[model samples]
Target: MNYEEARAYLDSRVSYEKRGMPESTELRLDRMVTLLEAIGSPHADFPIIHVAGTKGKGTTSTMIASMLTGTGRKVALHTSPHFERVEERAVISGEPIPGDRFTRLVEEIASVVEEIDAKLAPDQPGLTFFEITIALAMLYFSREQVDAAVVEVGMGGRLDSTNVVIPVVSVITSISFDHTNRLGNTLAAIAREKAGIIKTGRPVVSGVVKEEPASVIREVCRHLHAPLREAGPDFVDQYHSKGLAGGRVEVSTWRRSWPPLDVALPGRHQGANIALAAATCDTLEELGWTLPTEQLKQGLRLCRVPGRIETIRRHPLVITDVAHNEASASALVAAIPSRPEIPPSSPSPPRVLIFGSSVDKDWRAMLAILLPHFSHAILARYVAHGRAVEPSTMVEDASRAGIPVLTAETPARAWEEALRLAGTTEEPQEPASSDLDVAPLPDEPMICITGSFFLVAEMRTMMPLAEASVRPISS
Candidate 1:
């Protein structure tokens, strides 16, 4: 089968809601591993860093991959819930493999899957979308012989297909209430699900510092005989200072100490992510993957993740982040540069938020958490699935929050409204600066495109940011 045919084959499978649990469709999935084994367990070829978390896993994974790549290792990255392209989930050398390459790989895997199908009994479902992608990434990584791979678990870790591998180090970034319908509601329960990646005797590194959930991870590590390196105490030491280019940072870890290190990403969460990445590097060192310090540092400085505090323009700058859950929304709100407090000659751009999300999400809670930062907001509907909170209802939620909200039937229309409102005014205003000094917003109004991951995916296609993908950059 060719690429198009392979995509069709995968697309013909059930949706997330339709498929529900893998076990329900167990009869259909027997050949997934069989197919992989037939192809030679490519996942076993490389040292893997498995990451699982509700909020910060993506950032943490990106940081670890950046550090490894900086060290000149050919690294493979597989992150889920792609913002734009399906190929975004799998990256080689920091670049998204093209549609042609992805299609070709899927075709190859499909051929093997077809061959193994006869062995499966009836009433069983076949591989789902994620399973196929995971298969492709592992097969591709193994075939290319990558030095290391950074994997972000697609969903709850235990049943997650990515759990099939034995990783060198398992990293759980931070845990919070999310996917309550699937992963559970309480922090400890969520922690248990995230802790599933803890393999017996494998080293697990985590940034969890709170009480209930962090305690849960500790318990699992003890049970598994896995050494759990705590994020702050055992691995990372924090330092902060002012910088000329961006902000100054201090990162002290079990491996090394870099006080007043300059980091580009904004917010305290980023500081945590950096620390986690450092801890990850330390864990790798123990396993004999000693990378040069310069590369790690340079890689940290150079790493750029889009749709998560991505700056699009200057002067009314358009800062976009893909923060959907409560914890994530809180972080995004905290990161928005507040207009200067000091009296100035000029005024700041109004903070306009353009939000959208799946219908099942806790939109009320998510919107409430971010009410402080949004001077004005608009809600957009889902473009992919019809089951999204309507923009009109979102306006009602905003009204209760005492924040004015505009609405659009679809996100594409919402984008135009947000733009107009962000720059909209009955009259013009001036600019200003301050000494106690919060960072400044850019020339254009900041548009935070968030809610459903699918909405952000659509936004990237409709309104492209400067440039970001899995593809590597050339000098």
Candidate 2:
């Protein structure tokens, strides 16, 4: 198929998300393994590092990939919930694969779609956007003959589409409640799902997880005879700092030096993520893989994971984040710079927000976590894609949080309103022809773009070429 036709066909694959795994993907590993076998065993082409967790998986995956690249290894990476294209899910040597190569790879993958489908028979759920993306990464990595590949679990580690591979070392960053309807309800149950990545006899690295959940993971490690090294228990973060742009942490384990580590992504959560990445690096050391300390530090400092507390423009300093869950929203709030320090001469501008979310999230709880951070909040729905909750209902939910809010037809217009309020010179001052026309104010107020990952995904499409590098904080 041609490129546009291939893109359209890929878009059709999104419908498979509705076929939610009724049981944990971990329990169905046998089936996932069989599926891999039918595909010519793509997982065996190179060494892979499998990572899982709720919050830090994406960040940790990037850190690990960045570190591997430091050693001059050509690496292929696969992570999910793409803020842009399915192609963004696959990266080689810290850069996304080019579109022309991506389309050609997809065409090759599509050619095998019929064969893989027939192999599954009744067990087939059809290839999902994520599954197809993983297949692409495997195919691309094999074609490129990279030294190693770092793969993040698409969801819960065990049954996640990426779980079919046998990784060199497994890393579980941390576990928390997020995909409750799909993963599980409680923290322990969720940890159980993430623990699915642990392979027998493989050494695992972990970070600070809640007690109950850690206990669940501990039980699994014990059962699997998996050697596990935990961040706080086996290693600890010696120093932590927060700054206007972001912060750094110095980690000290038995083997690692007290090195200052920078994470371009905002949040205290990232300190934990860096420590997890450091610990994974230590695990790689045990496997005899060498990493350059200077390059590793550079990766964390310069690494850009879009939309995760990413700044869009200056003057008013517009920021965007894809913090959708309660824990993450709380982190986003803390990560927002104190209004006072942002502008030394200019008077502080009250926080204004353009927020949206999907139906998968707890509307009330997510709003409660973020509402207080803003003086004015505009509630909108991410209607362009699946799982969007209505904007009107979000406005109602924001009201329950006792915050002043307005509903918008779409996140795009909501963003326009936010900039108009900021009065940024780079933006159009007047509202477009629509049911709403927010008065354009001075471009001094700090505005944030947040809510669903899909919302952030759409926002990136509207970005200028220079703004394309910024994306939601992802693994």
In the range 254-276, model 2's lDDT, one tens digit per residue, is 68674798765557777788787
TM-score of each: 0.88, 0.89
Residue 118 of model 1 has an lDDT of 59
Candidate 2: where are CA atoms >4 Å away?
14-35, 119-124, 238-244, 339-348, 423-443, 465-475
Model 1 poorest 10 in a row by lDDT: 427-436
- RMSD (CA, Å), candidate 2 to true, equals 5.5
Go through the candidates in order and give each one's C-alpha lDDT: 0.73, 0.72
lDDT of 1 by residue, 279-392 (tens): 888778888877777778877777767666655443445556778788888877766665446446656566777788776678888888876677788887766766677777
- Candidate 1 deviation (Cα RMSD): 4.3
The residue-level lDDT of candidate 1 at 85 comes to 66
